[model samples]
Target: MKFLFPIFALCALLSSCQALAGSQAGTEAKFAPETITAFAKNVEKYAAAQGAGAFIIGRIGRPQQELPKGIRFTHTAIAVYSAITLKDGSTVNGYAIHNLYQETGKPDVSALVVDYPVDFFWGVHELSAGIIIPTPELQQRIIAAISSGKNKAVHNPAYSVIASPYNNELQNCTEHTLNIINASIYQTTDMRQLKANARAHFKGQRVRSSRFKLMLGSLFMDDVTTRDHDGKVVTTTFSTIGRYLQQNGLVKHMAVFNRDGSSGELL
Candidate 1:
């Protein structure tokens, strides 16, 4: 799902809340302990309804708006839910949910908090084709264990759940292996070292044929290598291979590779 905007906004708002709290002494505090505790119980109930091994991971609560009768609240929580199967061929479904709340601004200002709800709940009889499926006997045991409010069942080893679409995309790219050879090269003045690093990293990976042109930019070029299935390296060279490396926490900069083997644009 496209959760980028919402997640980013939530993170920013949460950070602002923390900054505001830190700046003022006793100016704001998290939600009441009783409210958080009740939220936790409700999370467990939600997990149990979904046949999940429920457990709360984290929580943050804050006061939002104050009404004449009670206080408005915003909270964020994380939970883990799981299903397990035992060795004796029994299955159990379980869930865990955590709830957190935080006050946005001062005592009675417009407050907002981000909720991080992670559900690890899965069911036995609700198996989908091509998805991870536990054995029938294992599923039964999991169901039995969760029904009794006990979490002792062992989950099936083959029951791999797909967390998200990005995970699936990464898994599907099994043909080529991508790696970062040198992150510091982009900051260096040496062109030869950068080229050498790129060559070493890109060699012997099975990349798509059409990606060659897209890989060649003015600043950096990609080296394509073809190898046999037996792990034998065959050919390697600087090719216009079109492959983009998408990373989360990397410092990205564009550099220029001159025709005369010079390096420029170190930014």
Candidate 2:
């Protein structure tokens, strides 16, 4: 009976191990294109309900105003009338704006660049609500690009339509909305603490951090800067400091400046 008991215990242990392994394997296999598609569709429906479309356009260094006219939507554009039905018996009307470099003359082989969120309107509020439906085909293309590990440079000019009066808020409000959306998309961390730390470290000191890097990360560090309260120039080292901030998710859209005495001001 003792020997039988020991054998039973061994069987139970093996069964438990097998069950755990199976659970892990199931989890590993749970990546589904349908799931991604469903999420994209839901976002689309929400954006439509908000009286906006999905699709956004902006360059890293350029002013949002400079976005091209062709990319902007007009009331007459075909995309506005197109509707996508959602699982909840609602429909979203919009089109997907892909980031592709517009070829000057040749039209066949436009390369893919960094994919950004496409919003229906010029304002961040409208853009934030825009739904980008990543169809299974789109997902497959993105996966292929990821597997290649290549940086696709998009040369197409960004397109946009005129801003509606309904979305034209104070410039600061627009800036704030832009920052929030960008941070959310990029998975940036809360900068309340990091900004405080940076201000404490760089105030009244000739430090090397670019205004752009201080805000958006190394990706756009080369294009941003600011003068310290004491009139000293601060530059960010794109290779080192910029990368460091980016990896830590401390990069934000707000400017970090030396406040009165030793405090950091996030503007």
Candidate 3:
């Protein structure tokens, strides 16, 4: 049984990392092509306005089978922006995006890698996105955590589309991101202790799914264990994390652009 579980876990990771293509049919985009294009072009501008520090951002990417509810964005990534000076005495702005990338058809916990927003939004299905600029204190903590490899340490590599929001044992992209945020705040890489603290600090959203969807998830995905959807209904997502930060006063500023091309403050 133990060996079998690992095999199943591996299968799930492979399916998640490689086939990032949206599982849900591309729904009608909320913004017209021009609007989404312009938004992508100005991503750096918006990110820069958050200050040259470590922050987090999310985008409405490939539609997954688990249709989101009351959430504006589905995928999340950490953005660390800084300035670079070239030998020619010119300064340029650049960003290193810290995110979890699932490899193609691999059954292991995805690793935390630095990806640019251009690459990050390659397959985005919507024009909407959200950015969370952490407080100065929180920003330093996040940067420290990443430098100390806490982000890599907390990742489970096993991808679960319907991973329990509370559990850190099996993680998806958002859960992995959450673990990193929690670990950074606590200043520890100890997974058990972080999970314990998260129980109190993190409150996930209650999401409901149909039996058909649950069955499909269970049959194909190894990480979506029976415990995922049986009892607790809450799941961690981009919006939930933003709400948590905003409610806790850890965020300095938050901005969200809806599918309608309208922009507003999240906090």
Q: Rate the local accuracy (lDDT) of all candidates.
A: 0.24, 0.27, 0.66
What TM-score does structure 1 among the candidates reach?
0.19
TM-score of each: 0.19, 0.22, 0.76
Better of 2 and 3 by TM-score: 3
lDDT string, candidate 3, 1-267, tens digits: 778986785555444422332212223555455665566657767666657488787876645443455555666778877565658999877766777765545533355567665555555766666788888998888888887887888877766655666766567677777887888787787877877776778877665545444455556554454354447556677778888888888888888756554679764
Model 1 weakest lDDT span, ten residues long: 123-132
Error of 2 at 183 (Å): 23
Off by more than 4 A, model 3 = 1-38, 62-66, 83-92, 107-109, 228-230, 258-262
Model 2 TM-score relative to the real fold: 0.22
Task: Using TM-score, give the best candidate's number.
Answer: 3
C-alpha RMSD by candidate, in order: 23.6, 22.3, 7.6
Look at candidate 2 and tell me the lDDT of residue 211: 35
Question: Is 1 or 2 the stronger prediction by TM-score?
Answer: 2
lDDT of 1: 0.24
How many pairs in model 1 have backbone atoms within 3 A of each other, for residues 3 or more apart or on separate chains, i.e. clashes?
37
lDDT of 2 at 44: 42
Q: Lowest-lDDT window of 10 residues in candidate 3?
A: 17-26
